[model samples]
Target: MSQGVSPAAARGLKYRALRALFRHFGRMRPAARLRLGRWLGALAYRCVRPRVKVARRNLELCFPQMSEARREALLREHFHALAQSVVDRGVLWYAPPEKVREMVALSGYEHLQRQLDAGQSCILLAPHFIGLDAAASRLTMQCPSGATMYAPQSDPAVDAIVREGRTRFNDVHLVSRRDGVRSLLRHIRAARPIYYLPDMDLGRKGAVFVPFFGVPAATMPSTAQIARTWQLPVLPVLSHWDAATGRYHIEVLPPLEDFPGEQDAEAATARLNALLEQWVLRMPAQYYWVHRRFKTRPAGQPKLY
Candidate 1:
C-alpha cells in the first residue's frame, strides 16, 4: 500500500545516524551540550541561509507591520534557536532522568492536575518549541500513561532514535498521524490524556480553513471536533528555553471550558487559533515560522509555498 523510502525518509535516516553519534559523544554536561548546540546551530544557519532567507521573506509578508530590520533580526535568532534545538537532543535522550528533570522545570502542574481532577481528559495542544521533546519526556515522567503523536521519520534508523528519545517513560505512547485519529478517539474514551501539535498544515482533506494572524489557513478540524463531541477540555501548553533560568519552563495554561457554542465549528476554531497566537507571540523566535502557514489559503488565493 505504500512506496518504499522517499527522499525525505533517506535523509531522515542519515540525520538520525548523525544525531545518534552526536548524542553518544556530546551528552556529558548539560551546559556544554547547549553551548555545542549553539555552535552547531550557527553552522546550520549558514548552510541554510538561502532557505532561511526565503522563509524570512514569507514572515515579512505575513507580518507587514514589522520593519525589515526587525524581521531579519528575528529570522537570524530563530535559526540560531533552531540549531540549538537539534544539539539538545543529545541531552534529552541520553542524560539521566534526574538530570533531564533538572533541566526542565514544570511551572503549571497544579493547573494540569486540577483539570484532571475534574474528571475530564485534557488534550494538551503544545506548540513546536525549543526542547519540545525534552519537555514532553519530562512531563511523561510525571504523567506516565499519557500519549502523544509524531510524524514518522522516513528513515527507520531515525524513527527508532526518535522513538527512543520520546518514549523514555515506561507507559508513554507515540501514535503516528496515519493511525492517530482512531487511536486518539479510543484514548479520549478511556479518559487518557493525549498531546498533539495542530499548528502545521495537515494537507487539505477534512480540514477547516480559519483565520490565523489575519490570514485564512487550513486547520485540522479533528481536534476541535473531538473536543466538541467528547466535551474534553482543551489546554494550551508551551515549553520554552528560559535564557534567564537556563532551563526549560513548561507553562500549562487555563482550560478552554467556555468556548461558547459546541456546534459552531468555525467560531470555536477561531478562538483556538487566537489562544495559540497568544502562546506563539510569547516566544515568536521559537515558533516554527518557516512553515507555510498560509499554504492552504482560503478560496481564490494562490498557494504561498
Candidate 2:
C-alpha cells in the first residue's frame, strides 16, 4: 500500500506526467503523432462541452449565413485543427531543428527579405491562427533577428516550455505583454521585425470599435499608429495546416503600400480587420475561433460569449 499524496504534490505529479507524455509523443513519426492528435481532439470535442459551445457560438456569430449542419461541421473540424496544433507543440519544442523544418513549407518569404535587405523596418501582421506557433518556429530559423510579444501563461512550468521552444531557433526578443507597447517599439526602432498579432479584443483602452465579420469588435489600433510613427512597412503573414499534405504553410505577403499615410488609427484598424476577414474565409476551420473574439461588446450592446 502507498501513502496518499498531498493536493499540491498531486498537482505537481500530474503536470510531470503530462510533460512526459508530450515528450513521448514528440518522438513519434509526424504522421502518426498528428493522427493521434486528431483522435485526442475528437475526444476533447465530446468531453469539453463548454469550449465546444464557445466555438459553435463564434461560428454562429461570424458566419450567420451558414446553416446549422454546416456550422457544426466547421466547429468539429476547428476542434481537430486546434488539437493537432496543441499536441504538435511537443514536436516543435523537443524535435531536432531539421525535423521541424521538414514539417513546414514557406512561400513569399522574399517579400519580407526584400524590405529587410534594404535596411527598412517592417512589421509582420500575424493574426491568431491554430498553427501560429509552428509558423513562429519556422520564422525564427530563417529570419536573422526578430521580436514578438506573448501573454505569459499562469503555470510557470508551461510558460518556461513555451519560451524555450519559441526562442530556441533564433535570437528573438520576447517581450512580455505586461511591459506594454513601449518595450515593443524600442525593438522595432532598433530595426527588428516585430511579429505582431493585431486582431484581438483587449478592451477599449487603445482600441477602437471596428467591423469584424460585420460585427462591432474592439480592435487594437497600434499597428497603424506604429506604422505611421516609425514609417515602417506592414506585411501580412498567414499560416495554416494543409490536411491533404500533412504539413504547415507560412506565407509572407507583399507589404501594404501607402498604409496609414494620412488615415487615422481607427481607419487603419478597419482596413486591418478587412484583411484578416479575407484570410479567415480562406480557411475557416484553421482560424482561432475558440477565442472569445467578441467578448468586449460596445456600450449599450449585449455581451457575446
Candidate 3:
C-alpha cells in the first residue's frame, strides 16, 4: 500500500471512478452502447472461462436432449445477453428517467393497469431475466406505489448507489429479504404492486423443492402463501433485451386464475417453475443461466453443479 494515501481516500477514489464509468455509459447513445457491450461481451466470453463453464453447466442440466453444438451456440448467445445487460445497467441506473422510459417499450401493461384501477393488490412474478433492473425501473416509473425485495451489497458505496438508482422515481420501497414476511407485508399494505422474483435458489430455508426444467430446484413458496392470504393477483412480468432493436421489451401478462387453491406450496411452486420454463424456452438465451439453479438438491440427492 502507498504510505501517503489514507484507506478512506482510496475507497472514495474507487467509488468515484465506478460512478464515473457507469455515468459515461449512461450518456452514450443506445446504438453506441450496444456496440460497446457486444465488443466487451465477445472479449469476456473468450477470457471469462469460469462463468462460461457455469453457464454451460446450467444449459446442459436444463437441456440434456439438446446437441452439444447447439448448446455451444446458445452459450455464446447467453454470454452476449449477460454482458449487454451488465453494461446496460448504466442506462437503467444513471440515465435520465425520461430517457429510460423512452427507450423501454412496455406491452400488455393493461393487465396490471386494470388491476390497479380496480384497487386490487398485485404480485408481479418477475424472474431473473437479463432485463430485470430495467423492468423494475419501468414499473416504478409507471406505477404510483410499489415494492421489491433485495439483499444489500456488502460494499456500502455500491449498496448506496443501487438504492438511490432504483428508488429515484415514485414511492418504490426496497424491503430487505432479511426483514422477513412482516416487513414485506407492511410495505404491501402501503403499496399496491410487489415486484417479486421467486426463482432463486435461496438454499432450503423457507423454500420447497420444485421441478425447474425437469430438475429439482429449491424454490420460494411464499408467493402462493401471500397470494392466498392477501387475495392478491399474481401477474407475470416478462422482459428481455432485443438484439434486433437494441432496446428492452417488457410485457405484463394477465394474472394467473384459480391458482394455489387447495394446493400445497410445493404444487404452487411447481406451477411457477413450469411458467418460467415456458418463457425460457421461447427466449432460451436471455434467461440468467449463470446462476446455480439446482444448488440445493433434495435430501440424500447428489449435487448437480
Candidate 2 at 205: error in angstroms?
1.5
Prediction 1 TM-score vs. true: 0.88
* Model 3: residues with Cα > 4 Å off, grouped in runs: 1-11
- lDDT for position 14 in model 2: 52
134-216 in candidate 3: lDDT tens per residue? 89888888888888887888876677667767886788788898887667877667547889998888888888888888888
lDDT tens digits, residue span 111-195, model 2: 9899778877788989999989988888888988889988877876566556666777767878888899778877876788899
Q: Which sequence of candidate numbers ranks them by TM-score, best first? A: 3, 2, 1
lDDT of model 3 at position 66: 100
* lDDT of candidate 1 over 1-305, digit per residue (tens): 01233456446757557656757634556666667666776776678766686668667766789888888777877777777666666666667777777877787777778766765677887876765775687777787467777798885767766776677665676778888576777676666688878777886887788877777878886667777778777777788886544577787777767753554776777777887777778887787776666667667787665
Q: Mind sharing the TM-score for model 2?
A: 0.93
Whole-model Cα lDDT of every candidate shown, in order? 0.71, 0.83, 0.84
- The TM-scores, one per candidate, come to 0.88, 0.93, 0.93
